[model samples]
Target: MASTLNTQLHSISFAAFILQEIMGNPREDETPQSRLKQVGMMSVLYIMHQGHQPLTISNLVEITKLTRMGVSEVIEPLIARGMLTETFVKNSMGRGKARQFAISEEIFEKLQSFQMR
Candidate 1:
């Protein structure tokens, strides 16, 4: 299974693997065209950022070069699936809190297995 995932992940982008293998189908309103765009953005984020650190939406935007809305679109579904976890980070300077995102332990373990292939 891990080898298969590795091959598939290399053949398609990692985001496609995550979307199809883990998250299931795209939303009803989403088209293949739109999903492709999001997949590209997701690939950028996954490739460019190491998951060891939790990242903010701004961090994801910077890493993926997507707008806030675009990042939200990609992230929300993962969060909904329990594949990603989000935490609130309060600003010491009295600014509003920021949400930080990280892969869930179960998903992270699965991803690590794929990487080991």
Candidate 2:
């Protein structure tokens, strides 16, 4: 979870966003699967922004009730896009650390200020 005390899941309408100025207007060049992937990525971002705990892959899987592979697919592109970041959190026992994720601060700032076109 990454949405803290004041964090809330902000609504992002994929259909509306795609129809707007993103990528300089709707692309006739893009594929349906690509668009779907965009939607999935946005959804994961929304969840990341709204959570209060360190978001782990397992957490995403549990939250989405999706298989690990499915969640991994959604997260990979976001990471590549620089929309998400991962950090290691050490265990209480000082053993191996776990990877936790959150929206990249830069991306989160942009998302916070974004306006629909």
Best by lDDT: 1
Q: Residue 9 of model 1: what lDDT?
A: 60
Q: Write the per-residue lDDT of candidate 2 for residues 10-117, one digit (tens) a residue.
A: 344333443242334334655557546656655665556555555777777777887978877766655665656878887545797866777667754554566322
Q: Compute the lDDT for candidate 2.
A: 0.59
Give each prediction's root-mean-square deviation over alpha carbons: 5.5, 6.4
**In candidate 1, what are the lDDT values of residues 4-114, reduced to their tens digit?**
876566545456566674435766766676666555645554554444544678777776677999789877766765656889997444688988776567755766677
User: After TM-score superposition, what is the CA distance of residue 75 in candidate 1 from its true location, in Å?
Assistant: 1.6
Candidate closest to the true structure, highest TM-score: 1
CA lDDT of each prediction against the hidden true structure: 0.65, 0.59
Worst 10 residues of 2 by lDDT: 13-22
lDDT at residue 111 of model 2 (Cα atoms): 49
Model 2 CA deviation exceeding 4 Å by range: 1-31, 91-94, 112-117
Candidate 2: count of backbone clashes, pairs at least 3 residues apart or interchain = 6
Report lDDT (Cα) of residue 61, candidate 2.
Answer: 70
Where does candidate 1 have its weakest 10-residue lDDT segment?
45-54
TM-scores for the candidates: 0.59, 0.58
